[model samples]
Target: MSKSSFQGTTRRGFLAGTAALIGAPAFATQPLPVQEVEVSQGYDPLRPPPVPEPPVRHNISSFQAKHWQPYFSNLHNGAILVDTQSRALHFWSEDYESHMLFPSSVPLSDEMTRRGRTSVVRKVKGPSWSPTPSMKKRNPEWPDYIPPGPDNPLGTHALYLGWKYYRIHGTHDTRKIGRRSSNGCIGLYNEHIAKLFERAKVGTQVLLI
Candidate 1:
């Protein structure tokens, strides 16, 4: 005879009794309810999380050394190359011993841009500013003139070019550097301009490209 029959108890009945004896719940014999999880559309639980890309920096200008021989015949007084596309200025000393690269602000638009050769005709420390007739026509509300001071548009110093109404100058608004923010001028930082002013002569050769 089987053990269950000999004991006068069935196998299933014995197991249920044992479960109760062990303090197992009455519903322990029944199947568990299925759980529902809310997931977003197109989301795959098996997929690995995506990595984010690095942010692009727009404000920084690209600076590099350049050869003066390709651009100029000779570094007579000195040579200054203003690269509008790169928004940078390059300077080479007369003896070609010293070289400097400075971030600069170029013309705001193509219409305002004047390319080709020019020379530093005059340099003024604590320079005054006067908006051109074209600038005045464009912005009638702008001031006619600005005296040399902190409020001056041409900050600290100015290098007047051979071209009429064009200058390589310093700006009080430093944000203008490494950008296309000038009406028709190439702009530099006050400190950089001051250094350039010291090294550069009135006859410094300038080329805007």
Candidate 2:
């Protein structure tokens, strides 16, 4: 659940304090966007840093990431590793690798190369894409909101990440799998995203590493 924080100071105090003297907000007030972030990618099990800083179209000066953890997310066993830098998502154990390994998927079209790559974070069931204002501006053809369903850009399942506007989610465009595509969202096989979406939870740590 979310909380609220407040500083018991007034604008008068704000003007009186030095630039650095501003009071810190109360910690108890609101839920931190990343209440708990841990290293999940095998790259550095002890500590995983943010992944390749992917680029986007029609960028924004700032994005609102009030970041409320969803009711469910793509929470994974720490042993599983996901590297956004390599664009590969891996699952491993103490001894060996899982039979299935997800290689870095990049789009082949020039349209895809326009932006960089990203990682998979949380997964959602029947996700609905509430296209951002920028998304609508870029793709005027886009819908105001994509209702949760099979045909949605978010597909039957979605693996959301902490990117500006990117997510490695399920796609109705199955043919785009294993290739560079999408405005920014990573495309996964519908079946795969669906299966994985069932296993995650909100607050699960997601590493772009």
Candidate 3:
């Protein structure tokens, strides 16, 4: 199959076929904390500003695979494992015995989702969107800046990876969670990304394979 076709098929297939994969329980042992913040304007040359939504409960377990048998022993505790082939992201517990694996969407093909070992360089809440140079070249109609809001592609939270311009972030559209739709960044459900943001700290090791 052609690379683009393979990517499109792989993303859909992984989401449909891997629902039973072992991981963390759908429900968390403890209640998630709540925080409130102000929204700010992002880059937008012509569009009106967007309206931000209040924080909501993150029922991540309902959409994630249960914690199952350990897989990568070489990885240290608190590491993140991105199985691009499986279209899933696994966050290891501090002991490395348990993990929470969330269904994910990757770049449409290998060229976009480059293999690498990196770390969480930074964390941004209500991150704004600025079209990358490549993005602008592909679609000149894209706005110069997008404010943080429901319409923002970055969703509620973003975990910036070590690679420049690459991130593990939330999506405004939940429907895209399991589809190969991004340029190269990892995409997760808004609630799932919020949950991950709370647990993932700067410098956390990330292995993308």
Best by lDDT: 1
Candidate no. 2 TM-score: 0.47
Per-residue lDDT tens digits for candidate 1, residues 48-80, read: 222221222223214444567888999999999
In candidate 2, position 159 carries an lDDT of 64
CA-lDDT, candidates in order: 0.70, 0.40, 0.63
Off by over 4 Å in 1: 1-61
- TM-scores for all predictions: 0.71, 0.47, 0.66
lDDT of 2 at 101: 27
Question: How far in Å is the alpha carbon of 19 misplaced in model 1?
Answer: 81
Question: Between 1 and 3, whose TM-score is larger?
Answer: 1
Residues 157-193 of candidate 2 have per-residue lDDT tens digits of 7667656566667665433433344555555455555
lDDT of 3 at 146: 86
Deviation in Å, model 3, residue 157 alpha carbon: 0.4
Better of 1 and 3 by lDDT: 1
Q: Which stretches of candidate 3 lie over 4 Å from their true place?
A: 1-77
Q: Residues 26-118, candidate 3, lDDT per residue (tens digit)?
A: 323332232222222233232222223232322323333423234344544367878776566878655544445566767866778878788
